[model samples]
Target: MNAPAIPMIFSAHRRTLRLTRARHRSAGSDAARFIAEDMIEDTLERLAFLRHEPARALVLGDSTGTLVASLREQGAAVEEPAALDLEAPHPSGGYELIVVFGLLDAVNDLPGALIHLRNALAPGGLVMTHFVGGQSLPALRAAMFAAEPDRPAARIHPLVDPRAAPGLLQRAGWKDPVVDTHTLTVRYASLDRLVADLRDQGLGNALAKPAAPLGKTALARARAAFAARADADGKTAETFEIITLTGRRSLAGT
Candidate 1:
């Protein structure tokens, strides 16, 4: 798995495992798929503005092919990125619409990855992406920080900043890029369940050098501390800051 330039993110190959698991164990089934589905539907709607059906479409980081299946159901041809070489240059323009979801946060070389995606698109083609980033899990982060203050090597999963989206796209030769964000809050019956869900979701803390595995004493301490911060209803709050991005490359220009 390629390490992303951004610290603490999962590797590309491992992301599928994470998302698939997350999707499966998602406590709020509806909310779990909300972001991914919303991104796909929105991207499709935007591509409709182009006034023609794209003959070739590419879907990046399409683990389990939910989006790919949707596109195929729409009668569009789809190519998935997880099966390709992340370092390879994008193939000559063949796709008119390219949608990458939940991947930017994990790829080791985001700019390089975007450039490849850009190269695969036909002139004037559009590329849309949604990724987990930008202070998405502040509460969880805060708890971790409180649990271990001196663990600088400890890293949680890395997320992209919405503010960095435009620059990243530009560096990849994507013009007229637009990036925005939204927040999602998820709940857990208990701090323990929440942590379990995170692990099942493949969002296991990937800190560069996390503290020693949580033994019974440490685990109890962390849990008690987390519960102390729980809301009146007794549910722990988890935030996910999602970033939505869109960009285009001129015909034969990129």
Candidate 2:
């Protein structure tokens, strides 16, 4: 894919998301769906098998605060970053376990970011991450096109294709890197609600230069297009393909 040409994500965009964390926490239990609490829970399940429970863990994006809490419940010490800028280089060494949630897609340099994550781990330390991936939001994309058939603006951030992930992991020097994806389908009553959920989940526009919001007339068309695709249940379907990655700092050295 032509990833480099696309300004994947702006650092400032993430700061806004972090600032809104309180709003997400107040959205009630159902907010988990938007904040990806399920994915964090799923990944946490695998921690049952770790022979070494991490004493110093760094959590990159736990907007929901679920993963960090879960780690703490295991009697492990967990710390979170005050601000995480995916475009910048991080310190080379610290932390034994790093569990990232919902932050990778906006990164401008995937390879460098991955290298930083690998380097952040102490020897024998592990890094696990999840983010929305390539096969995501086809319905929303179609609606955007219908909104402005003549000239559709770039609204969505460029996402990582799972197919290209393994090679990237290896290139970053993560030993025995693993990458996989699972699809989650959600149905929305209207396009507006979908957009609201995205904002509530900190998945709002993170592009370096975001397009202007749809004009009044264009929005009407996009809503109509979205309604046209609704199933008999009268809800439009949107798919999110969650990609998971895991790698470790090797005792044997890279």
Candidate 3:
């Protein structure tokens, strides 16, 4: 029997456009890079703790460029491709280390992507990927709901739940897979700032069929709803849960 068809919920073209726009924004101005920085830091720490040194590494979705520099400083030959389609098979393989920053969350066939990552690695190679998890953006979600309480649309892209990651890794044939999650909290004075930050960090919606833009009245309602949840300091707290998945290819190349 043929495998079940993967749902086409996300558009690869839109995802590329979002990333391109984010790169342009970052180049023209000092856009917020806290998300990428955090992922790089966490990845470096994990590499250090495990004492796993790689002679060759492939880094993906590293908008900040710091991850590549750091890896180079460690004497590793790193490849930072200008563009790569996560849903398709990688052009090159035999990487000893593969680190992905943010693209996994937007891929339509996540399990297939994971399998591709595993296939790209050499025997005993390590793969680490970090992306926003399902529990993130409660404040933004609430505000979107308030924008169209009666006829809400699908504005936010669905995220991966940490609970389902292990099964995905197993299906991908990863050896010694590990799934971990942590939350980052940020305080925003307004919903606009929050949305801007998300766009700056390349976390914009990449759904195949995005909802129509909010009108003036709906936007006002969203702003008001967000402001209503502000704390005494006149800022609303927003949480982002980052999920990290790490695993190694079997020595037998399975």
Candidate 4:
């Protein structure tokens, strides 16, 4: 499985995902561990251009305190983020903005989750959900197949395509739905470093039934296959595609 793909049609058990994300809460810096934080900040900056700033904000799935702090620094009264269920709508509905930092891909019910987010917002509020998508890390995926050429179990989640997001947003009753994608290319020295970076990003296995780790022989083959893709500089390139979905809760309930 490529490190950059998001779990779109995922059989991810919610408990497993929660457990995986919990590690970040007690851990130190999340820098470079994942790419969503930086993208979230960028999206916020874009929002600022539209004169959009939250008076009462809620940030879901924030691994670090930085985003929460940033909201407060901007004078928004923000509710501290947690590993809350996206399908379950919050009873309170006065938030001017809601940001889902890194958990939308693995959700069990994408439309239901979006609806819950919409319902949790006050009229004219905005919700922005970010995740990884598009064709990411083809080399890594090929290497994984080389690891178990015959019977490779599923490990990576197939993230939702950004192209389909606008329709989904409309189905969920989001007004002026917007969906966009950004790409980042990173070079790595070895697969080990790549795997480490993934774990650091709180991207451990969240599958309902995760495949067992590859045996030593299979791992060796995987390493060799991965190494074969290295460039002249002895580094391999990986692509990360970030998808952002933004919409407004309609005042007229459209």
Candidate 5:
């Protein structure tokens, strides 16, 4: 029997467009990059702790280029592909280490993507993947809801849940899989600023069916809703939960 089809919720083209726009917006050194920086730091720390150095590595979705530079500094030959589709099989394989940043959250067939990543690795090779988790962006979510209280649209891309990652890794045939999560809290004075930060970090929505842009009245409502959550200092706290998944292909090449 044929397997069930994965839901077509995200558009690969839209995802690419969002990333491209984010790259353009975040080109300057002064742009917001807390998310990418955090992921890179955690990944380097893990690699150091494991003492697993790879001769050849593939780094994906590293918009800031810092991760690639760091890996090269570590004496690894890194491949930073211009474009890669996670939902499909990687063009090449036999990589010793694969690091994916911030792209997995928008993948529609996440399980399949994991399998592809695993397949692309050589025996005993390591893969570290990080993306925003399901618990992220509560403030933005609330504001979007307020924009259309009577009929809310899908304004945010659904993210991966940390709880489900281990199962996905196991199903993908990864050995000794690990799932870790950490939250980053940022205070924003307004909803527009929060949205700008997200765009700067390539966290914009990439749903296949994007909601229409909010009208003037709706924008005011969203701003008000977000402001209502502010503290005495008039800044709203927003949380971004980052989930990291690490695993290795079996030595037996399973």
Candidate 6:
């Protein structure tokens, strides 16, 4: 008998992980490594404060292996899965904790992803997810939108509203879901620099239907509008609203 084929719908999503690694390698800076380090430290601190003992953890979208490395250091058996969509069926065994950082925005099946995440957790297992949401980079979004007003296809990816994320967790059968938001302010010297950052972060707009490119006149106008909003210090302020959602598998069902 032939072995069953793995799902094909998730293949494209998995390629995103490879793309993320390429960006990090091409950057050749400590930036990616540093971001991973900071993420792990913050997560560990949060877990400690909650008096949680992590025995087995799964780090979703562990592109660069930073979080997985840290969890392994803490003596927790860690599984770093590269699949991005999370549409596949959950594994039979349960994980004590699941950490998903910076992946949901790119996943096509957000609701299905959450369901799979919940199903993978053991009774009372906690799931922590962090993603960009709610008016993040509005200035940039506005500029891009204005650049090619005729083409709505050029609009960036739709972000989840922070206010609605907690409810999504609950609807997915998680218990005690909580959602919180924070803004990351990054100052750039110019619009070009900001665009560069976005590219390096693998955040370039991937709209299925992209708007037409802005003509020279429109591009100039958009640039002027962005710089006009720059701070007195001559730095453009880019805001990324990060939504952190946490929930636990219902103990009553398991």
Clashing residue pairs in all predictions, respectively, total 7, 0, 0, 0, 0, 3
What are the per-residue Cα lDDT tens digits for candidate 2 across 1-254?
Answer: 55447344566655456436634553676553554666777677767665658888998767767778878988888888756665566654577898877778877778888988887888888999998899999989999999999999988887899999999999999987889788888899999989877766767787777799899999999999999999999999999899999999998554
Task: Write model 6 residue lDDT over 1-254, tens digit each, in one string.
Answer: 99665432323433474456534653576333333333456677778888777799888755456668777888899887555346656765488899986667666566778989888898889888876787788788777766667753444677788777867787788888888776777777677777666555545554444456667888786787678778899888889887778888888644
Error of 4 at 227 (Å): 1.1
Q: Report RMSD (Å) for each prediction in the order shown.
A: 4.4, 3.2, 1.1, 5.3, 0.9, 5.2
Clashing pairs in 5: none
lDDT of 4 by residue, 45-79 (tens): 87787789889998876665667888899999999
lDDT tens per residue, model 1, 1-254: 98645543434446555665655555454333555555666666666775546668877655435768867877888776444545567654578888876656666667788888788778888778877786877766666665665553355766677777878888888878888787778876666666665554445553334457655755566677677778899887888787888888887756
Off by over 4 Å in 2: 1-9, 13-35
Q: State how far residue 254 of model 2 sits from its true place (Å).
A: 3.8
Instruction: Quote model 4's TM-score.
Output: 0.88
Q: Best by TM-score, which number?
A: 5
TM-score of 5: 0.98
Q: Write the per-residue lDDT of candidate 5 for residues 1-254, one digit (tens) a residue.
A: 99998898998988888788767877886788899889999998999999988999999988888889988998999999867999889999999999999999998999899999999999999999999999999999999999999999899987787998889999998899999999999999999999988888888888989988999999999999999999999999999999999999988888
lDDT, each prediction: 0.68, 0.80, 0.93, 0.75, 0.91, 0.70
Considering TM-score, which of the candidate structures 5 and 6 is the better prediction for this target? 5
Candidate 4, poorest ten consecutive residues by summed lDDT:
6-15
| TM-score for each candidate, following the candidate numbering | 0.79, 0.90, 0.97, 0.88, 0.98, 0.82
Which residue segments of model 6 deviate by more than 4 Å? 1-23, 30-41, 210-218
Rank order by TM-score, top first? Answer: 5, 3, 2, 4, 6, 1
Please give the lDDT score for candidate 6.
0.70
How far out, in Å, is residue 51 in model 3?
1.3
Please identify which of the two predictions, 2 or 4, would achieve the higher lDDT against the true structure.
2
Instruction: Give residue 46's lDDT in candidate 1 (0 to 100).
Output: 68
After superposition, the stretches of candidate 1 with alpha carbons farther than 4 Å from their true spots are 1-13, 16-32, 48-52, 91-93, 196-212
CA lDDT, candidate 1, residue 146:
59
Give the candidates in order of lDDT, highest first: 3, 5, 2, 4, 6, 1
As a whole number from 0 to 100, the lDDT of residue 28 in candidate 5 is 80
Candidate scoring better on TM-score of 3 and 4: 3
